[model samples]
Target: MTDWWLWLYVASMAGGTMLFLAWWARPCGVPAIEYQVAVAVPVWSGLWYAVLALGDGRVTDPGGQSVSWARYADWTVSASLLLVALALTATHALPRRHPWLPTTLVGLNVTMIAAGLLADLSAGSRSRYLYFALGTVALLGIFAVIWGPLRSVARRQPDGLHHAYVEAAALLTLLWIGYPLIWLAGPSGAGLLGPTTDTALFVLLSIASKIGWGAFDLARLRGLARRHELALAGRP
Candidate 1:
């Protein structure tokens, strides 16, 4: 049962990586940094998912909880790239308070996920819930940064780009918020969702979040680049 889901996830990741790379390779005058980050996010995410699939979707922790450490590793790198892409897209609009604000936020977000993973691996039910609470707190902090500083920056982008940024952020946020709930329903929590359903839910979310968002961002960048080229050509 779960094997089918695992294979499907692997296939989707492979297909998505190919498609994303193809779009990424096309010529676009968008900032190289933005382009690189956009491409890297999904590519790396797919790679990690592939690794997870090879390992039969997840590993059982000491407490007999099914844990996807590969997914955590994926989030650590890919999530930071997602932020970097957002930051780069809004570079001109971001506040000048701190040069390393994006990097710091990325680190914090990765730490939050890592903490949650550790909590899921804990032996006792009480520890599981406690660490999960702590992870949730960290998630709230990350959200504050996004909805606060990041939103401010995004709002200053040009109309089309601003809309794109908002869409990307909204989609990513929606998928991410569900993750904690899924955790609660899985082996570590109430065990209501069983491994198969839990694995399926994650696969669907990963497709929507990483692959879908990457494609949208790539299209937005290409459109912006085209408009810029046209504007430059029309200049006196």
Candidate 2:
């Protein structure tokens, strides 16, 4: 079941990658970096999905569960690109403080994924929950960065960037809440749900978070660019 679902997910991601690339290829006037980063999100995730689908992604966890380590790698990179796209869209992110806030956001995202991976890999319950707690903390840090400094940055921007950032961040944060919840209930944690159900939840979440969210973001930003309300982002 896992293999079958993973293969299906790989196909979905492949299709999403092609669609995202095609969208990016169009002469949208949005910032090239944002569009390009949006494209990279699915491309990278698709490749990792392919790796897992090929049956090379399984690792025997200390809990004797078959885990897909590649999924963690995929999340780390793809989610970071998502953050980059968000930062590029909503903030001037350059020529000041080395774009520390955006970098900090990405770092927090990576930390969250890494900790989740470590949690799954851990043998003992104490170690696993410890890592889970760390990941949750990192996730909170991400939210803080978003609602804190990133919000402040967004508010100062013109061209409807403030509203855009708030909406995008809200969507992303809402979607992200599912990950740890699913992980906690799935085989990796309490084992309240079976692996197949866990995979299904994750797959659905990935589809919505990556492809759906990316489309919404790029499309809205493109509309803003067309109206000449977009600033700081490079126009075609």
Best by lDDT: 2
> Which residue ranges in model 2 land beyond 4 Å of their true spot?
92-98, 229-236
Candidate 1, residue 31: how far the Cα is off, in Å? 2.3
lDDT of 2 by residue, 32-130 (tens): 677677778878888888888787877998768988899998999998888777776567433343278779988999999999988989989999999
Pairs with steric clashes in candidate 1 = none
The best candidate in terms of TM-score: 2
User: What local lDDT does model 2 show for residue 45?
Assistant: 86
Q: After superposition, how far is residue 17 of candidate 1 from its true place, in Å?
A: 2.1
**Candidate 1 residue-wise lDDT, 1-236, digit = tens:** 77678677767767777776676577576655565676677667777777766774477888666778888888888877777776666553344524465876787787788788888788887887888888888788777777777777777767877777777777767878988998888767898988889989988887777777767776777777788778899952
Q: Give Cα distance to truth, residue 181, candidate 2, Å.
A: 0.3
Reference-based lDDT, each prediction = 0.74, 0.82
